[model samples]
Target: MSAANAPTQSQLEKDIELIKLIRSRGLVPLITAEERPDVPRLSDVQGDVIYGFPKASLNHALNIEWFFFFRIADSGSFKAGLSNPDFKPTSSEDVKNNLLKIGKARQEAKLSGEEVKRVKLQQYQIAFSKTGLLVLGIQDGIADARFDQRCMRDDRVFLGDQGKWDDLFDKPGYNEKDGSAHDVNNPRALHGVFVIAGDDDKECADITEKLKGIFKSSIEIPENGIVQGHVRPERHLEHFGFRDGISQPAIRNLEYPLPGQNQVDPGVIVTGYKGDPVGSKRPDWAKNGAMLVFRKLEQSVVAWDNYMLDHGQDYKDVPGGKAGVNPELSQEDGAKLLAARLVGRWPSGAPIALKETSLKDDPKMGEDPKRNNNFDYSVYDVPGVSAQTPSDYYCPFTAHVRKTAPRNLDPYVARQYLESGSIIRAGITYGPEVTQKERDDKKDSEEEKFKRGLLFVCYASHLDSGFVRQTTGYGNNDFFPITGLVPNNHGQDPIIGGPPAKGSSGEERDANLDAKPAKPFANGDQLDIKLKVPGDTLNRYQVTGHVEIQPLTQAVIDFPFFVTSRGGEYFFVPSIPTLKTWGTAN
Candidate 1:
């Protein structure tokens, strides 16, 4: 690299300080950065520092993760339990330190040509709900209005929930049928959730039982001691048979990101840092902490499979299929292709942006880190494929992944939507694999014992700019990414978007897979959508020849809500030092 391109001496000093900060917090910098802003150490951040435990340090298999939800019965005892030196919550710093130790041991053993010793490992993290904070006398708000709301149940309107929330979301006596809160309005059902993760389920269970015993008097433990969740036997695939956790955001200073992974500022995921949406509005205790959104999303696997079987080939008619004629793909492959379009990726996690190779599930390309996430929406990254299909032709605008993260198209939208609104997801799939009988019947089992879904967990600096905005502004909104483009022809996100509320005025809950450039103007002409915002005219992209005008401008499809919200709660993951302060009475 030339001297001009090389990092400056000041940048090197900052990097050294960043490394020192991490080491001080018992963490090792896995990937070095040329230049990084001063960020909080992993020691102060709770939960998985690098988002979900996709893989363990040195390629160790991640086995299972558990969520232990409880209610604080006695504030004094609860505070005392938190203060107790014996009670140690999982810190990302310790997890990284363990990883570093394992890596070192492996390196030493390799040099000697001998076997390496197995290092025992476990991860633990703790977070409290708004009610949890209230029980501990934290009357001061955490600079997030959405986090401070009465409950997630009440905030469902913003998320477009159709009142299908699970009964567990309700308080002890609240009724689900008639929408009666009873006393639920007074106090939220759950106080907080304790996260325990490791390879050994037995060890995690034992630890959970021990903690329950310790905090028995302080909190009310559920009858089922731990809500166990595990990575599926099918590897990275979720219950619905789709690969998840594929496109996690890479924090600027925290991780060495892959080719096309979105890199965000530390303030996007953690508080009291540069670029935080709330800026200096946060309290001292909330520094290094993050706003956590937890949800129990139940997936109807059989129903989803049936939907795929019935409508998988629907996308064959979408305007820009290769060479303008559908490929001679099998019915099964066709269904799988449709599913890929809906998800914006194949079952193996290969993005549909590479529509040529992605016509069939490209396991080789999906698993390759260098290639899996290498393509932006605008630029087709596949070699030998020179098709310049723009205007949501190759990939739908409402596809789950595109709706969630509209890469390269950020310039057309509001400022900092990608940077400030992104979240660090650390969710785990819950429940057993689907039964053959359920599949045969084309529906989920009526029995509650056979229930399955995701224990969705994510962290961000501010709720409004992060989770809420992404869900409401992008996923749920019809005309998002392009305002006044063919009216409500563009649809809501099929996978994560909520259904329309009952008794509401005309709100079409469908997805438009094929959206061509509206007419009078041809392919190369600028899109005629209304531009009220500044900078909209600066980066207008000209359409390529591959964008064919379809017969119907509003080509809407009724994609059922295969994933339904069972219930959820918002929590605050406080810093380590702030947690220690809870032990002493104010």
Candidate 2:
């Protein structure tokens, strides 16, 4: 065929590749099967695989998760369990099918004027930690050298070793004296983790029993290794009162795109995709696999709330304090503003970058899908308000969102280099709600003393640039993005950043705010701003400088750790076909 007249690959060929990819790798939420109108739906893709992502099932009210630490007593028995058709691993396809059936049932019930009975379907996924694979003598199956290296290393070193932990201004319980360390003995020795999520407690318990039956003879469940997590009754808020999972990056090559979401290349998440940024080619068997980083973080609700109560007034001294813009703010309201600044968002999940005034009282703004998660840090004015100068002056550079994502604030080279650092977070909060009475009582029952936090889970293509860099590089460092205006020895992330030195008491972290620039006014001088109209050819303003407004600067008191790491592990979620092969392997 002539080069100019050569035919393009048919839609059927593309569909086959897509199915093979989904089957080999897992499908996440928001992926659509039909990307192009010309493509005829394949039977495999149309049936059950075409449904919604399992982790994001809309009808799921409560989710229960269990992390199992098991040792393989007999490889043969383990393989037998893998071979059982009833115990086969749940694929994204299975989840989709279940959701479709449930949706249909609900619709039929609604049409018949009958109550839609809750479906008690249980969903489960299994992943092997590096230790689990080693225990099973399957280390050779891991083809990525980075995964292999990280898998072999302890998570303590990845997060913060004894030295790094000691350097923090406020020491976490896990890093405290041996007898007092939280999670000191629990998650560190785990071999593998099994996650079971369902609609309610009964479904979760049933699934747990089924899992026990599969590995009863081949593994040992550690006393404390099994942890449970559920969605809070308030919906998406975490223990610290911040809305989470709201700013996840959208994956490209999906069937559908979420409105206002920025889509990243598939290589940023899935292995073997063209967007994979690593220099080396992944192994054949490792194709379609993803690296999973798990962490059990406990949040001290009392301590966090206490810190805010004690230090809220100090926020006014910090740069970018809204008191400069809104002179009517009280000390209490200023404290609330400070709390919002530390979190990078208001309690309602509204990004501070979206408005000049604190949206702490405006819950509706934060709840509006069209407003939240919509602003970029590089812009100065609110959307549609172009008369103001463009800058990152409103939101502090070290704000949690800015530190993690940076968006246009990052240098072009660094931005491109860190593309692989993007990851998909699939975590749920664990712990009971502490009542106001409990806080005032100053005494916690034994059950209330039980640690509560997030079961942090994230999937990435590479550990080094993904989770590792995001933590050790960005989360730990104070002088990130390297903007010239940032002060020397600036403060680390207040919410998650560790202190500069260990064993220190009452230390403070530095933050620089890009306060609105001001010019000096002489006695009897009047100020006037020529507002730019919509169709003005040039949007420009000139302010005469008698004295410039210095950037707001302040130090935050370093308190005891609020979020402490309990345990974690690295695992590889492989293709179903690979699991089948392992099931039959000698």
Candidate 3:
């Protein structure tokens, strides 16, 4: 209300122009409160903190983006570029300020009866690899083993890359035996990457070129540096035709938690926060920074579709088939059902856990945040459902979602996963949609220049506890969730899971689609006991004794290869102050 603090007319005009630019690009400038969990306070560290990725909804955050990877040539010049206003990365406070300005400008326009226009603003963020740190003389390191591992090329054995690397990532002159680039500081080494995003491709390109020019002497920008990704126009789907970016964890303070969304402390994501694995031992300059995991996963759409079609009619009996019920489904419907079960959601983004028997996508439920991510894969959350928990009777334990986040499977496991194993996914689909020819042929054509895949990007404070664990430990591992159920191993994650085979395509894996607990769970179906109150009169299911599940006729499904990791690297996103420090000194 104070006049002194009021924004000047010029500033208001500037904000309105910003809004218009965004609208011109067909984007909404407003970021949902529930989706901005990574944004920190403006006053925190004098507005020095930077977002690990765009702190907006998936649509807004990745509308149009570019990942420009470069190698350091001159350390002094590269360090100086960090402080250059034109070349520096965008700060978290800058994003928050823009959101506020846009809001204020919209309100002013509404009051003045002026037509409000949306805004699109480009954001630039920087992250450096371990070698980049050494190049910049941060010799002590950030103290993360997985990150300090140096080259993701070496991680191929565990990540299952199997030498299917893009030429750009698999540059020459690396020690083939040890998987180390012969010269760590070579001009071809991946030192750092710059992420630029907005709604304009030309504008993004211009910025990319500008930054390249600015750091021309300090770095070498390869052809792959121009790789761009975009969010599909239809329902925000990925190349796989499924709605993506659902079920992201809610940060404790940054966002208003959605129903059933696991909310963790900022330390779980940003360093120097409450839940960080390294705790206060992290260097002071590394505060507010997060580790970035960048993986380019190429999807074989044709192969996946054919595999689903081939197995669609072979439906598996549920709940251990105790009732000897195997629902007959048409091949068409069966294929859809198979895909949904594999992804743990329909193409519309609805959770298969909530709509287990449905063969069609629930557009309403999928788009409804209040319901889409509200399921916990247990009968305890299903209304009016009487329990005898059958153990993944609805959502298969091998389903992509369940494997990545076994929410509420076990209280301790869920808590532990939320605390350390979670990652903030801000990836965007890269390449192009499959062509009609490719679809008709039931395979991607050799003539097709661009392949379709996901530019998988995620963030976390501890690389080991976050992305690495989710991929190698859970997604790729069998016998996870440790449910002590019969059959022991549930299966590998159907989407991204890789069995313990290194240097292989991971083309085939086993999954228990119809898992059953040796004995039925005691608790009957009821609203989550966690939500129950002392005097609440809600009916609760309580079947005291044990319930037994009979063995199913069909239990395991042979999973096929779908996602192939082309290449990736782990980078450290430093704080604004840290950048300034690096720029001013070594």
Candidate 4:
């Protein structure tokens, strides 16, 4: 498709991809710029941005938004049993205990295959202490102007492989094996806002701290301009349960992306869609700039669990007994399956309903860095292949990744993108891991039951198309049409759909039979699962019957929806140049 016709789905996909990078390394929540004014002023940035925000003007002050991930800050003091003094760190010898802790963390960190573990071992390497983060939600009105004036002209610091594309192509992963093109315009990528969060952890922290002070005490910005980084515990699991970052676009020439897409030209993610309705509205200052959407979406754990219980199936067995709902499934075998279907991937990060190449995680394949995320879903010897296409399966349609971009099933993945195309998301998990207080309260109040999730902060080329279009409609809305194999049966995503209520329509996901045991047919409120016989003669083709999806959008079927968004906000990350000019502009 031409740039003008670029789909909004592309932008949201990039945001997911970007955030996933942050999650894998535990290095997101990139800090940038110092705040000063009432409405903090920002330097003009390049490219399109997302989120609902205010316009920056000559008389305004700068607002510097900082990201504070819950995991990094949730101190042991908050919870009792889970993080007691003897949990691991408090009572041990400093270095000796730290080594053990590092070892344990390393084991868990291998979710990215081995690349993440092998990359480096400094706590501050990815998200440094001194590094300042400047997050923004480019207001819908001035997205074009802010992006142009700030993005392209800025130093483009903190971010990697951005300024250097050609050199990345010569790396080992770029030459062969994966056939997918690494287009810069892949829906999942970042285009605007140069990061000042340096390479070292200390530097990142130090700079970030200093910048925070600037936002708080500065005289130039507005009072409401800068939103201090504080832990918002009540709302979403994390700040706002954004499946913080997944599905980043692979920039053309950049070698060995974590996985997902290829690259393309910077322009694709820096302007409005080629034929976008808002393309003609851009101003001179917004030429190369992109939009940034900052959402504060909240998740209702209690409600989510209740929805699952009301509509989900019962666990026939746990390690010792049978338990089906959240708490019941917490440590049960079924718990793992429930969470897997919810996230569309095993906690190991493996997709449940979908598997790209094989069921197992391949070190050579999973850690290829480049080829890992580059595969597009090709039909399984036929057109409109549904069950585990070449790209990804073992998950559900509404799962986070697929819901955001919809993948190549559209054939448009290979086409030229619209100006307001790609998006690059980056966020961090926030809040405590299932707190006792919250869990206890959940038995009665859903508002108190949620576990920690991710604080979502994303950058996109266009606001309305990228972040706005996707979350609000593409993946956010339940009615988004799924142009799938069965046409009418193409349902919305089951795991991470954009439903109004967690599961207002009541849904259920069906997991085909696993090796150990299979969940029996369940009768839920609006969700019911009954095995179907595919061929002419009814009960013929059958395997290890498992559970998959019954989406909310297609209420007729029983797809249990897992992930949900509660609330969020919009802000802007000005270009470094924009930051410097903020106070002085007027």
Candidate 5:
């Protein structure tokens, strides 16, 4: 995909028209791609567009992030806050300049044999919801249909449907009839989110102090928005102990592309770029801006761990066990394996399709980008094994990774269309580490003592076909199709899946996994596989001697509520020029 800086004459005219429309609506002046300083070009690994917000940046330890929610109490005060040189919203020019300075600093530090303690400056980006635009006094007539349709709504994009709410073990806050913590009516409803990220807590705190003073009475800092720091030790891991953000699509304009990373068109993410993913006519003001989806997902770690302990042993008879490749593992080890299958990768970040034996041994493999994310479940050729099958035998079809991407399995009209579903995930795990004392206390509830979960943030041009489709169509659907596999309702995603309704009594919803019998081993031992379908109480097959007649073994497990939605909103991250205009507007 070509860079967004250059547009044809007709397109340029459209941009001009867009600017006029925005001005007519009294919108803050937005920076156009043409006016902004060129993003410093660098190698694929170092230089790129959309600085400071990508999966690679999360690998840096000591990283601290702050989420600020502000309500425009007085439009003039808010404008004054934006105009303040010290607390002015960061522009793309600011980001590029900062990156160049940081790069130079790193090089100087390395040459001078000096330790770089912390970045003196903090990096932040500003985005606003439809409510925020209104608060800023932009008329509703200026907003486009797509933005109005998505950003103006308060329902949870993934779980708001009545059917899905009924199916979940614990409904999201918005789903409840009574106003709750996450309800739209709650005071937590926010108009804008300002994200500040730094090298350490001190830097973040310093920036937060400055921002508080700058905005003062214009913004409301809710108690909930105070500060949710990222957890330690397992910095990148989610509360459930799985490495998050392992899978991300490679953007077209990047210089360096990692192995197995799918290259997506710029239009798929940035608005008005060539090959716009939405394929619908949009207002010119929408160009160059991207939609942001935010969700606060809280995890029940204690409940999740306990469920694994009770059911992990059941998977011992799974693929590895039947193939005789797996060692005789204790109950704890068995449970760990079961957890990995649900997550699609081990805690070490290694894909299960590559390593199935011991989760701890292949830490090196997981760290290597070339090998870590290179597996395709649809058609995989296992290393050192000659027999290649098109089935997702090694990796379950319902695995979190499989359900989200589906890779070649996507039935979209073309391959590029399939790649459009990709979104840049900028999520951070928020919560405290479980203490040994907390782990040992059998009677104590960990959920009560600790608040932990994921702050899911992603950028996409189209919410309906991108983030919404992945969460609702892929994450929620159980009967997601796979070629050559029989049509089976594989149940909800074990980790993030929600049931159609809360199960009767205390029993959780049942999720099915299709366990294909292992191919005849090279060692010449025929493994006997016995499949048990839960709720199969009638013994109908027992009388017919058809126990082994079923082509695939279906293992049904009780899946409980693992993750719950706290709150979220949709926002539009405008260009730097537009922000500047907003600040200086009369």
Candidate 6:
């Protein structure tokens, strides 16, 4: 069913003219020999240039497609290095084994085949390297600081010469008024990051080929075009285990007919949501600007496993406390249930609690719009009884989705109606599947396991409003199951928050951490559910054994960040002032 009638992709040409007129304020598009395969390094305009989203109709659209990107800072030694023990890079066989284990459990529970993929992903995201990557800390501006001393820039900066250094990441934010946000605000700054990936070596080569051609050829767009990077993050499956990106918007108004779906109000991604002031209040150069934040967080499986061994029984997989002593649930089953609560869906993408761990894949029912988004958190809020026992029974308050956006439990009416899942994701996994040798040597030490983790990137309009604030403060609170009443309820998102330590929190005593963090639940569900769990139960487990992170100096990150940035920069993907002004004006 063609649910949408997207505009013919004849809009890319129009965007070119406007961009040529403004020509990115600070950052220069590093047209490498390969990227500029069609033309020489500095080719003159052919007849006319087009820009923006050729995929959509640009007629009379005020919003031009903005290109938000971070050039990799390091750009060296592009190796996956799975032999290293740092990330515990799971092998192809290991992935298959884990999948098999999850599949058997689902089958025994009677869940269908369709739900299996979801469970596989939960395991995958944790065990492997992440998709988008980022770097934090200090360095001189993005340009190589050592280059200046090496005399690479002596010709350009002091000797009044024409030559410059080959350094990357040393650029400024764009500003028309003062014309300075680049290297001038100066020195190494904390750089945000993102990237597209390949199906294999060949696919990446194919993308590189396409990109090289595009950067070289100057094409035309219809009106004012926008460029949205689309990727298939599915060597496994789509996010949350469904064929996502299908439900996303194509054209603002023409294609999308839903209410408030015309265009996300500017405030959605741009900063200054409700009362925040705009433009003038910002720096002279940042008038219509936005900053992106990116990070490469590695999930620790060993720690995560240890926590589950101690806490899995509360969910019916094991008995609470002392894994060796408890006779009820097997260690394996406990691991299974713990994984289910954190993801809100079983390995099969089935909401186990919704269906009581039947493990059947209900595609039509699972993917249905109203039903898909329809879980209510209110029933869990009540003190005495839950319409369904085990309030966080199916999903924990600390699960990824629940912590990010508390569906239905609208604390602030305004934010509730508006909250969308965290900013757009541009990611690619690094490192290979785990190997048998690494698995066997798992106990050797933290330094002997995996190479990398997810290189996660996010697009944000502002620092406080986007990535920085959430991961730091709001991202991991645990008060989700309790609903409307709890103190400082920004609970920990179990999937990303790292694991709660052994013998701490209800997850230790009860599989569900959904109960109010403030108000607790007791040991058993059938006999008596208590209003509060004692303070002794909730232990704070260590999130990660992070790799050494180099600091950022002079605004640009120093050479060696955890993600090991290669190269990247900020660019203004412009609107169509060309046909209206640039083309005619020139």
Q: Which residue ranges in model 1 land beyond 4 Å of their true spot? A: 1-37, 49-59, 101-119, 172-188, 222-225, 322-327, 379-390, 483-488, 500-557
Report the alpha-carbon TM-score of model 6 versus the true structure.
0.43
List model 6 lDDT by residue over 1-586, tens digit each.
0215222334223222222322211111221112122221111111001111111111111111122222223312111111112322122223222323433444434444443222212111010000111111112221211211221121112111111211433233422222233232233322221122222334334443443233222221212111122222333222222222111211211121222111233333333232122423432222222333333334344444455566666554211224433345566666656655665554433444354332233555343432433454435533564554324534555655455544444443334232422333333333333445545655212342353344344443433344433443344333333444433243455545433232233232323445465633332111222333457576544221222222242122111011122222232111111112222322
Candidate 1 collision pairs: 90-124, 166-566
Model 5 misplaced regions, further than 4 Å? 1-62, 91-121, 140-147, 150-153, 157-188, 320-323, 355-361, 380-390, 410-414, 442-449, 481-487, 499-557
What TM-score does structure 5 among the candidates reach?
Answer: 0.72
The lDDT-based order of candidates, best leading, equals 1, 3, 5, 2, 4, 6
lDDT of 3: 0.66
Best by TM-score: 1
lDDT at 11, model 1? 63
Tally clashes: model 3. 8
Task: Put down candidate 3 lDDT per residue, 257-343, tens digits, no spaces.
Answer: 556777777788778777888866777888878888888887888888888789876666443342333456667777887898888
TM-score head-to-head 4 vs 5, winner: 5
Q: How do the residues 396-501 of candidate 5 rate in per-residue lDDT, one tens digit apiece?
A: 7777877786666644224565687778677777777766665686322435337677777887777766777777667776665344346556656765665423
lDDT of 6 at 571: 21
Candidate 4 structure quality by residue, lDDT tens digits, 241-273: 322223455432211244455343433444433
Q: Which candidate has the top score in lDDT?
A: 1
lDDT of 4: 0.35
Q: Per-residue lDDT for 1-586 in model 1, tens only? A: 2346555777655544444322211113444423344777666677564444433213344568887888888888888887777788767666655555555556566689987755666677788887778777887777786666556765554466664566556454433223222232344377788888877688678778767776768888755535788877776678878777767777777765677878778888889887688859888898889888888877778887788878766655444554544555566776787788788888877887765654666887777666778877764454543434335656788889888877765345543567778887778888889998887887798676898988888888888888887887788766656632244456788878876432245354332325564545442232224323345666744321112233466666555676777677778888878888887763
Q: Give the 10-residue window scoring lowest on summed lDDT in candidate 5.
A: 40-49
- What lDDT does candidate 4 reach at residue 299? 44
RMSD of 6: 19.7
Better of 2 and 6 by lDDT: 2
User: What is the lDDT of every predicted structure here?
Assistant: 0.68, 0.56, 0.66, 0.35, 0.57, 0.30
Candidate 5 overall lDDT versus native:
0.57
By how many angstroms RMSD does model 4 differ from the true structure? 20.7
Q: What does each candidate score in C-alpha RMSD?
A: 11.7, 15.2, 13.2, 20.7, 12.7, 19.7
